[model samples]
Target: MTPHILVIDDDAAQRRSLKTAIEALGHAVHVADSDQAGLEVFRRHRNEIEAVLVDLSAPERAGNGFLRALGDLHASVPVIVQTSEGATHHAVEAMRAGAFDFLVKPCSIERIAAAIDSALKFTRSGSQGKPVRRARTGTVGFGDIVAASAAMGRAVELGRRAAQSVIPVMLEGEAGVGKEMMARAIHATSERSARPFVTVNCAVIPHSLIEGVLFGQDSPAGSGEVPGKFSEAEGGTLFIEEVSELPAHVQTRLLSVVQGGEIEPAAGKRPRKVNVRLILATNKDLIEEVKASRFREDLYYRLNVFPITIAALRRRKEDIPHLARAFVERFSSEQRLAKPLVIDASALALLTGYDWPGNTRQLENAVFRAVVLADGPVLGERDFPQVMAHMASVRASGDTAGARSAVEVGHAAAAAVQETIVHAPNPAPTVESPAPTRAAASGDLSANVIISTDEAGNVRKLAEIEEELIRFALKFYRGQMSQVARKLGIGRSTLYRKLKDYGIDPDDPQKHAA
Candidate 1:
């Protein structure tokens, strides 16, 4: 049987290029543009399909579902996720979700062939080939959480243990690290798995209605008659997200519920006995809040009985590969696509290197955008423009390792020029102004100082006056370009850019006449 590979990418050119390249490597290639289409093709030719090359760059999607589907159909069949530069967020997710390998876009033919060759050698140790093995219950724990790092492993271990008891479990971490998901997983594994599970994000609810929303409202104003989250989750789990955002009164109300194991309805309704278990999640520190008197100390103790702190993305970048892959599959399944998008190597490196101030949720949003707008199945550095731009800026500054030195140099130069102008000799007092002078200040040597103003009192553009200052400094410093740049309080490169912008000739220093 001729080894056939299925290439799933939205870009026609990329599909054609890969097909031609893979075929040249002595294997056949089948191409699909979307996840739905790819899955159909993979199922139809399940046995004939040797490997799958998927693009997981769509910020809005991932190819993992298709890959997972294909895996179930043919567990031995390997799925190679191809991503563009700056998109490694999905690499681990792909691997954890059962992908054979990960590759970056525009990778060499030899590399692709090598990965495919390895993938073909794969044999599943699991039960079946690719029947979407349900994650015990849902996408939360077990294989769902996708932990590889010790930090995450410990956090997940705690979460699993917290499921055994009906005690209130409080999850602490930066938002978007899947606190709610953990709550659900705990609910699924507990005795309350058959009961209802309700989630209430306290931060989003109106301050006035929070109590009523959480503790059954009895014909409350404007809200009509509504059961509180407590009643809704009776005999089940109630996950309160952003729990600290609840107002002081709500906190008191919640305290009663936790302490007395009952809830009081709005407008003086009878306090009702409730059997709802609490699963609270907060990005804020409950201990700190308790100390600050913002959160009740007693309530904090009750909820903190089973605390599981989900690690932030930055602290656990090792898990980025799995998290990224999981999100790719997660976001991709939500969209209607013919093929799974791939994140390029550069993208993966970018993601891995990023600080992710926004955590996993931020990564998910970026991936969603990449998936939705990516032209090809490839998500490269260009897919996440804003994030890549920040990363690039940080890289530029870090690369020099002494950008501060350059800035300091510019400031020193500008200070010298200021000294010459303010204390040198006043340059005969020009007719346009008073020798283009002003009081010296810190932080910005050139800013707020008068150089040349039009007769109409309109302030001349800073660049023009800056050019004049540069020319004046050059002549004053005797054609020393370095001196002029220093007196200007800006880096040499910045001075050069400014010089070019203002049409200043650094070679000819005597050219004044500002």
Candidate 2:
């Protein structure tokens, strides 16, 4: 069952964006615009809701009040706080008030998903919940496939339904999307679990030999019989990979086997009954192949009976964090690490931002490489130099196709709403100075900007100048909190508070009437 999460945030845009991102993580979300609405939703669906996400920057500090209300109601669901204020006091206060986890704003979706996963795991462990049963390693089952994204979840659900029958399942997806893995899972969960699961890649075999490799052949030397994959998987499954590459003649033979449940052991030899289940996988679009006169229409119809299309890795980036973590755990054990190495948030963010062209296979190999070279207990951003380099190259080329610089949710809005608190060095007492040169060379243009003067040529209010500087700093640093805070000579909490006080919005800088 998918976990249900309750999100309480007064900002409608934030609520919508959060819901979009969270639902992609394979969870059901219930949202509220206020603490009272949140409480009503939680109370009505307390048994189903597994976690709660609350914004700590709500008006009147409603997040803090909600925390106290949850305590009063004796709610046990883990509450994760996501706030714009990056102050130590804010985090400490939330933790002391019983937040299960704290996340700073502009947080990566991967980090939020990881935190929710941990909270759920803790809850399950506390409740003594047992994991879903699955086949041992090497025998892939639906349970072993990480379907943390809705697209993959739908595909997995289809595969599960197909596994209950002996129907021919056609898996269509890009190479490395794990079509073969899905085939294995289907076979493992089917009634043919104990039977042999033979595999043959039509694309890899020689065109002349693919037929013989699939349907068995009589020994030309008359020494004995040459058993093909179908014979080997009698009363079991035969997973034909790259099935679109099968020869025209082999397609006819495969069609016969599919329609009549029989296979020819050899040319001119009597047809033999084989109880093997057929699961064909192909990365090609069979419909296009058929239109191109490359594949048999009848064979396409036969194999397309139960089609399941696995989504590419990029289309389902929400699953990257979980998949990467699973690979890290597996490789850590394989490499025999002294301690299980964990992936840091920065590293996960880096990975989740990239569009993996090779899909899961690529991510798996990347994690394996990182695990082998890592010397520390945690894998950091430095561990993935190749990915970093690729990301840099992509950014340099202005190629949005390769990777997104950041997650889309509230990224621009967050950037627009920052404040600057950097205190400048005290000016020399009434110095007679020359005209100021461009401050761009020193990378502090905000310092040299001409202050606004009134109609009488008098200097403007200090508060007004401060607000302009804050806006300049935010634009200068590109919304990087650390850089903005350091340049402003103030802490992040102070910057956030100032931004609130000045009513600074990325869309609308000044809120007060002129």
Q: What is the TM-score of each candidate against the true structure?
A: 0.53, 0.61
Worst 10 residues of 2 by lDDT: 427-436
The TM-score of candidate 1 is 0.53
Which candidate comes out best when scored by lDDT? 2
Relative to the unseen true structure, what is the C-alpha lDDT of residue 45 in candidate 1, on a scale of 0 to 100? 84
For candidate 2, lDDT tens digit of each residue in 258-345? Answer: 8898886655678889898989888876876886799999989888899887767765554676787778877776776656677765
Q: Indicate which candidate wins on TM-score.
A: 2
Native-vs-model 1 lDDT?
0.65
Write model 1 residue lDDT over 1-514, tens digit each, in one string. Answer: 6788898887777778778878877888889999888888877887788788888755567566875676566455767776532344465456546565665433445446656775565433211222222343443545466554434555666777888888889898888887887888888878888899999999999999888788766563775667888889999999999999989988887888788887766556677899998888888767667767898888787778887767667545545645665566555555655555555545665566566768888988888888878787667778889877875686576854322211111122222222333332222111011111232233446553555778898889876676667765654443434456677787654665566567765433334423
User: What is candidate 2's CA lDDT for residue 495?
Assistant: 72
Assess candidate 2 and give its TM-score to the true structure: 0.61
